[model samples]
Target: MLTLPNILTLSRIVTVPLLAALLWWPGWATGYLLGFVVYSLMGVTDYFDGYLARAQGAVSRLGIFLDPIADKIMVAAVILILCAAGNDRFPPLIAEVHVIAAMIILLREITVSGLREFLAGLQVSMPVSQLAKWKTTLQIVALGTLILAGGFREQVWMHDLGLATLWASAILTLVTGWDYLRVGLKHMD
Candidate 1:
């Protein structure tokens, strides 16, 4: 149960609070830079955990279960922290329409989670689609770029780019979320 891959996944879950703390101050460029580093490291761990698990043939039920949970937790924490920190300061980090994108991502996460559970209860496995994988990639780039933007506050371009990807991810989120719901509904009464 305690394989290295699983440990790596667990480490990401363990590191969420520290990431949140580092991003707590929107005005603190130093903190944001460090937060970007921590966030990057977490992303590294996320990749290696699965790579090592497959390479070593150590994949377990625990690993399968915890991986997505760790990802969601990390994403949610970043979104919430960014929103809160932005509000705490003057102009919001997630700002106006970007907040809607964030909300879409969050809502889709929760809805998909519930739908996944429902499908699992019916023993109907709903595999992630390729488009969903693209959405996940967009989400990673979007959030990471946004965090990096916090580090480089003067770089309006970074923020703009981040928001662009964010909106893109949200659109994909809607499509993928609907796909999951459609599949889940097939199993329902």
Candidate 2:
């Protein structure tokens, strides 16, 4: 269970607190910069953990279990931090929109996770759809762009682009979440 791939996955879950601490101070350009770096590193580990697991035939039950949890934790931490910082720095219109977008994505994540857990207990595994993977990719890009925008708030366009990407990602999230629920619901009966 303590394979290299699993270790990488575990590292991401462990580093979330430090990431959160770095983003705690709103409008601190340096903190946002550090947060971006930490966030990028977490993203890298997320990719490599799965690749290494497949390549090395180290796909253990623990690794499979912890991988998604690590991802959700990291994503949740980043969204919360960005929302807090954005609200404190920007005016209500932009801040509130971004906060709502973040909340939508976060809510979908939690709902899907719960559905997956419930289905797992019933020996039903709902395979990930292509749209869900695209949604995840967009979500990560949107969050990364938003975090980078926090440090570069002087450029109004950066925040605009981030917010645009955020909304796109949220739309995809809702669609994919519905797809997953549709599949899981059939298993209930």
Write model 2 residue lDDT over 1-189, tens digit each, in one string: 799999999999999999888877766778778988998999999999999999999899999899989989998988877766544345422366567788889999999999999999999888878888888888888878877776776877877887898899899998998988888889876
Against the true structure, candidate 1 reaches a TM-score of 0.97
Per-model TM against the reference:
0.97, 0.93
Per-model clash counts, in order, read 0, 0
Instruction: Give me the runs in candidate 2 sitting further than 4 Å from their true place.
Output: 86-94
Off by over 4 Å in 1: 87-90
- Global lDDT of each model? 0.92, 0.84
The residue-level lDDT of candidate 2 at 183 comes to 89
Question: Candidate 2, residue 144: CA error in Å?
Answer: 0.8
Check candidate 2 and list the clashing pairs. none
Tens digit of per-residue lDDT, candidate 1, span 14-106:
999999999998988888899999999999999999999999999999999999999999999999988778644446578777899999999
Count of clashing pairs, candidate 1: 0
